[model samples]
Target: MTEVDLQEPRRVPARAAGALRRAAPALLAYAGVRALGLLLLAVWSAAKGKSPHTLLTARWDSLWYTRVADFGYGWEVRLPDGTVHSNLAFFPLLPWLERLVSAVSPLSYGDAGLLVSWLASLCAAWGIFLVAELLYGRRAGVCAVVLWAVLPVGIVQSMAYSESLFTALAAWSLYAVLTGRWVSAGLLASLAGLTRPVGAAVVAALWATAAVHVVRDRKLSWRMAVGVLLAPLGAAAYVLWVGHRTGGGLFGYLDVQGQWGNGFDGGLAFARFVGDKFTSFPSALAGLGLIVGVALVIWLYVLCVRRGQPLALLVYCGIVVALALCASGYFGSKPRLLLPAFPLLLPVAVALARLRTSRSAAVLGGVAVASAVYGAFWLNGSGPP
Candidate 1:
């Protein structure tokens, strides 16, 4: 009877492990946060008299993704001057996933994108939590996930953005690299590359970390080298294909991006734009605020580097930020676009971990409520500029 009693508690059977894996505590916490966020999204849509489904699938960039999934790629629309704009500009992984889901589920292409991104965001939160736990501790991991959940830019997670999906893959891939699971890291990094252009950054981080390990060991490791080689294939192949179709080299896709006002030369042009904004009282105040915000971002990077952050994390965050900030086009979306850069959460995570539970809960609660309201406002077109 005593043996039975002990075995009962240990009866977490091997087959049941799958369910437990899916019900990860971190994932549950992530879901609670995202559910609150979705509530805000719903309220905002109701106020605008826009169906959340439509908004999810029909918005600015979502439309492009849906068209790509529904009709197929290679369909181009021509401007008056006979210039062609193809949907090939966007990466394939998101739409491809959408197609796969729609084939097996009742969800439409647009809704599928929303579903995939929403789920992927939760996965990202879990992955980040795992990384923090591995590096710091359980408390730090929890804090990191909470910070990500209530981040000022949380609204993007519910949108049709690729940030969440890329982040999930990148975080777990980096975690795998740290744990010396080279093949797994390479696989996840490859998927990340398929998800977004910045995936190359993750690949670079992995390769760099592996190289350091190899050099320190003073011997060549085929596993590490193979992992490094596998990282860039997905992104590189897609970009090369885009170049072939667009009648240029890799520069062709970049040229197409420029036509959409997204040329990447350096951040000098954006700095000049912000300088012009300082000419008026209101603009000056706003510009000053923007400058302060940028400074905070820079300060966080400095803190991480100075604190002797892990090399992989530092490089990953640095490359993502540099690419986003230095990209000449779409200055307005810089903040939103850089949401996938996960390393920025480290300092805040570290701080939160040291706080007492009561204090941490109070702070997270306030941020959660405010984030909900801000998300609603953004959706309703009344949010901060």
Candidate 2:
């Protein structure tokens, strides 16, 4: 049994009360940080004569999701350059949830989307804590949740976006894998795939771990085989359906992303995007900051590897970083895209766990305030796209 399973008499979440009590501290901290961010955003937006509620629920991708939820796909925006931005690019799971919530409640599509995101953020926090607590200890788990909460882009977690939903699914999936619950892991991974394209990372981790187990131990359970089979179903099903709809076969999704100027270009495009920043004097500092941020991400991944984190986490983190950093377009969205990569913060959390409670609390508190301010400023501007 794993560390988490050791003290537990049961593994399923049927003990909802027990699970909530165990995760209360981390969840509360995460909620507190997000609440601060929301409050700051409201104040900032009020001063600017904008609506914080609109920023969170009706802008950018949130609008696209609400569109998808309100009217099923086939909606396309034809650009001046003839490029087509299609609603088919968005996966179905989030919209589906929004629809479900709207059907059950008095909330409109945007409000339902916001409600779903808020609840998913809590689930993500609880899952992050569980994974960290299992790997290190409860203290490290709490620290990880707080650190994740205080991320400068952490305010995105409160928005009507898929990051929190996807992260919640991915984290719990990884935890299920670690605890030898292969079927549970695969099921969660499948759902995660339906949430975001990075869901493939979760499937990859599951398959890789299952492969390692089979090869090394020369043993495989029926559960393991079933899990391996189930891991990719969500993504595969959607991609295939898109292909069938567009009559482009398997490359339909790629065509959609290409029209959006997004793809895995091995960071060449991203490098050029950063390099262009130095051509002007004022933008050079932003470019430098971007470089430092990328370097910090790389450094943390290296630490996770050197520290011998579980293979599942390494695979998940590596793919997440690679995709977010290497995508050719939407540089501003990189940080938000990387939000679900909670594993990269585990090393930081583990390190912070070494400090005295008072010292760590002070440090995290200061950072939280800074993050809230930054979040307010970020959303008041062009926010995550």
Candidate 3:
């Protein structure tokens, strides 16, 4: 063979190996946590005569996503109560990926979705590690990934949902922003916008950071200008398309969500939902749990602010929390919606970094096991919708 051919063959494998080596730590942690969750789910589901894989790959929102993948949009279901649930409410990127992957492989749309979510979750973990590593150190970065994996709703990361895909984009976009790679950040932010509605959080973070930089320097660089201009296009394009298709003009997308009883009421609906939980004696405990959960979320954000987390992370996380807590629909789905707000765990990661290696490992391991059990139980019962 010619010298060029020899070098090309060697370079491909070498680069692949190097990339895998670099990502091994985060990927391994992600795989371990997800495997534990799957294992527990399998055992629990087998006992209850349910299909764990179906739960992960086909139930709830996963079904909607796959439906969008198999058949293009414009699908809706009307209940006997006259409520209409439209697939347009779901962003398109996840289903797009599902269609692309299933077209090239033997996997069904559901399996393709599972595959996409699995790989995206690992990418999300690695991106999260990079962000934490940039802000703190490698130890804290590892702990941050561990903390994310052990969160109560972390199991959703393994399911066929947009959270992992959006999170991977958001984390990498924030990392790019921190490193001053504005174009890359903007591109990722755009892709995130296509992945989930909260992708606005990423776009807002990029815009806010760019604005701060301009205010400080009294001028905008060409790259920053391009990035700022590019950040919102993905979401705007999708919304405009939806509007045109539904014949509702600019408000068509909002109207679709409204039909499903979703809207931004500034948390009034959430407050009433919580209060209603207290009407019965047993539900009173559930209401108290909701109070404590909200309090904890607020406390962690306060800690992040006090610790002076980077502006990009703070902006992204704040918008995520606000959207999750303020949304009026699916009160039971708040925790799953908050799964992308991984930066909120920075405080816990920093605290874990301060401990001895053995102690941190022990704590994370225990939490991983507990989270796994909880995930199995949660999925077997009435889990996130």
Candidate 4:
């Protein structure tokens, strides 16, 4: 073959092999933790006469996604209380994947969603490890992956949710940005924007990084300018399309979210919700726990800033936290929403990396069991997950 053909064929496999070698250990550990969570969930569901598969694939947001796949959007519920719950509030990427997977295979939409989510979670874990490894080292990367896997809401990573898919896109996009691959970074960010509202964090981070590069170097590269241009297209397209459909113009999507009682309220709604919890002794304890959780999140961000994490990571993480915590919607979903904010775990990962291997493993093992139990309990509870 000619030199050009030979070079193109040889490059891809070499890069894939190198990435596999670098990420193998982290990926293996991540798989192990997820497997344990599934095992515990299965046992718990069996005891309660519930189906584990139903919990993972046919409930809450998963059900909405499958419905969108089965019957293309335009679905809405009008409650007697005068509230509108519309499937249009959900972004289209997950349902599109579910539809595509179901069309190509014998699986149902729910099955396809679960499969896509499980696979995307592996990709997400791998991307997270690569980012941590690039910043710290392989050991810290492994610790970061473990920390994420042992989160109280970690089981959501394995469920038929958009969190895993969005995270995979976000992590890989951040990695691309860190490595100065502008076009790839922008493309990934655009895909992420199509996945979830938090994708704005990725787009903002890319813009912030590119702006810093241009200002510091006193000139803008064509690649950087193109990346910036591509970053917002996914979200803009979807929002504008929704506006056209609703005939409400630019604010149609926001109107839909408002109908569902979801909006950015500067944390006033969330604070009132927490404050109400203090009226009873038992609920006061939960309120105190909420305070501690918020404080911990803030402390970790300060540590990240003091330790000099990359500007892209900080901005991405800051926006994710702000949106999750400040939103006026379901209080129970905040932890799950925060799943994509993996950089907050880095300071913890760094500390874990300093310990002996055996101790670190033991710690992770204990937390993994606790997380599995908590996830099972959380899902089994009467409230929505």
Which candidate has the top score in lDDT?
A: 2
Q: How accurate is candidate 2 locally (lDDT)?
A: 0.90
Residue pairs in candidate 2 whose N, alpha carbon or C atoms collide under 3 angstroms: none
Q: What is candidate 2's CA lDDT for residue 201?
A: 94
lDDT of 2 by residue, 159-245 (tens): 999999999999999888877788888999999999999999999888888888888778999998988889899999999999999
Give the number of the best model, judged by TM-score: 2
TM-score of each: 0.90, 0.96, 0.94, 0.96
Better of 2 and 3 by TM-score: 2
Winner on lDDT (2 vs 4) = 2
The parts of candidate 2 lying over 4 Å away from their true place are 1-15
- On residues 151-193, what C-alpha lDDT tens digit does candidate 4 reach at each position? 9999999999899999999999988888777788899999998
Task: Give per-model CA RMSD.
Answer: 6.8, 2.6, 7.2, 5.6
The full ranking of all candidates by lDDT, starting with the best, is: 2, 4, 3, 1
Which 10-residue span in candidate 2 carries the lowest summed lDDT? 1-10
State model 4's lDDT.
0.89
Clashes in candidate 2: how many? Answer: 0
lDDT of 3 by residue, 123-172 (tens): 89988887776666767888898899999988899899888999999998
Compared to the true structure, candidate 2 yields what TM-score? 0.96
